[model samples]
Target: MSNHEVRMSEWVDRVLPSPTAALESTVAKLQREGQTVHRLGLGQPDFPTPDRAKQAAIQAIEDNFTGYTDTGGILSLRQAVCDSLRKEMNLSYEPDQIVVSAGGKQALFNAICTLCREGDEVLIPIPYWVSFPEQVKFAGGKPIFVPTLPEQGYKTTPETLAPYVNESTRILILNHPNNPSGAVYSTRELLELAAFCQRNNLWVISDEVYSTFVFTPEKFTSIAAFPGMKERTVVINAVSKSYSMTGWRIGYAAAPQAVAQAMLRLQSHTTSNPSSIAQKAALAAIVGPQNEMEPIHNEYLARRDYFVEAVRGLQGLECLVPDGAFYVWVDASYWCGRKLLGRMIHSSDDLAAALLQEAGVAVMPGTGFGSPTHLRLSFAVSRSELESGIAAMEAILGLK
Candidate 1:
């Protein structure tokens, strides 16, 4: 009750710190102290932003295009979004249906806040992006975690999601080419899920930030592209992952007209339009020639292969070859209840801490992704870093 004391909002207690960002900060602090830390925990790509985008941004700066823009984003950039979606996903959208925000996170927050009401239940698949459940809780909705099997490629089917549905269920957040797990749903799976959602009268928030990284024979298909799904779907994508413009911070959402406007209204009160220069850069990236894409994708595919093999070679660790995205979801349950380095390995947090302290390697523990006995490793780093990380880990755990 003291005047100098300020009470924290109940919202502050609902969410945990972002595990990935926390790990990044720890690694950064170590690096600053001149330590050799192998970074396998972060989700950012190592590639540089494309030249066309960079040049466009520089030009915008030179032209003094630095003022605040329309809250929903400039018409040109929104139009570019529509064009990109139409060409890439075969989904038609108008500029008015798109809302550009600071990043995919903000766009997702806007959608979750605008659609999710108090007491609504949102179905979130396990091994989800770390922010999904937290965002739902912040929006006054309860997050219903739907666990998916590793054998099933860490994907949710109607069978897996059915038991969690009820009248309070309002939305299903689908992250394809999913973060951490790298599971990409096929067209058939999308159709089945689409039917399931329609039958349940559920809205879907499709997060497609990694849509460009599919390595499987089947191309990526958004649930929004399925019959009767677009009307109730909010599709989110960002140049951050696709074009390696993470620092530029431009992401967008495509929804029905009403939903899009609602998101825009929310965005207006928050971080209005993203940086104007970044909007220009994103427009250039979207409308420019995409010749550099295939090579970057192929590189990620090669890294995925090498990293998966290296991980499986380590004793007490197993992982499935990912179909898309740049992460390997590793099962480290073998180490739980065991001893490593004369310490108890009770969960992935323990394993991760041991690896970081004793082995100089940093990998994401899976507790934040809803499984404490697993780990998430990123292949998004350089091939040399991946090899060094594997070697560092092998030094601690030994080869299988």
Candidate 2:
């Protein structure tokens, strides 16, 4: 290797490019070969941004709002965030405590950097979002994974988390309406967990980006809104899922003033500020015709219902009905450590590879989400895609 062919820093090298994004490239290549692909690899929404939000961005450009704004985001957008929190969650947060970031991804990273240090252990639930552990590792912190099985509705409980808690434990990353596993904790569940965090003096980073996708009769509850939790909790959310504005790059975190300041300090040098136009769009999203969410929510609910029924009917594949979010997590443990169709299947990754190559269906492997022998099929794709993907997966597994 030449001197210029140097290695990336340990931190950067430790993280894999987002698994979903990596698979997108493969899907593109396969499609270019004139092959059909059913994409469930990424959790990105397929809906367009609300017209009101798009119009706001267009107006911002016309109004010459292209220049960089404050590093913490424009005051109006932050205030909108605060107002939304009050209206929806009945929680109060000063705009000063909010830092609008490029996406929920960046918001979470900022919070992690602010609270975690070398040797600090952050408790993360199994079947978590792919980025949580990697972000903690990048920040020089250790991640202690707490298992949450399907029987528990794939949620972290005080009892399940207790054993992982030790003197070194400093934070807990909770993503309700969880990414792959669409587990939504009940208020009672959160109350108990909040008590546990209080007992341990631990900080909580609550990823509520999918808060609006909930389909359960049990209401979505934020841990940050509970008694005695606001000071120690960082609530992370975005307009990506709710408003179908993934490309807008607007997510925010509401935290204690000190922690918010630390995040702002770090972000000021890094991203400087989220896009000014995006902020205007976000402000419009927050205050726009929220009725647009009804149709989007209904579509996700319909898709979720259809996908769950289809998956459970397939032989050797078991699915848990997700209460929220657009992902349907299925147990693929039947294929683990087994041989099928001339391939040695040992892990979720191997199975996912086989399916992608053999079936032309792209699904995310559970290994990326801290689970083995499992797969996460995103229902965010079109119904036709879902029908085709399910049939392909069912046939590959020898199901009628």
TM-score of each: 0.98, 0.97
Residue-level lDDT of model 1, residues 1-400, one tens digit each, is 8724877687866777888889989999999999999999988999999999999999999999999999999999999999989999999999999999999999999999999999999999998999999999998999999999988999999999999999999999999999989999999989999999999999999999999999999988999998788999999999999999998999999999999999999989988889999999999999998877889888998998889999999999999999998999999999999999999999999999999999999999999999999999999999999999999999999998
lDDT of each: 0.94, 0.91
* Per-residue lDDT of 29 in model 1: 97
Residue-level error in angstroms, candidate 1, position 162: 0.9
Lowest lDDT 10-mer window, candidate 2?
13-22
**Clashes found in each candidate (C-alpha, N, C closer than 3 A):** 0, 0
Which one wins on TM-score? Answer: 1
Error of 2 at 34 (Å): 3.3
**Model 1 Cα displacement at 308 (Å)?**
0.6
- Clashes counted in candidate 2 amount to 0
Task: Flag regions of model 1 displaced more than 4 Å.
Answer: 1-5
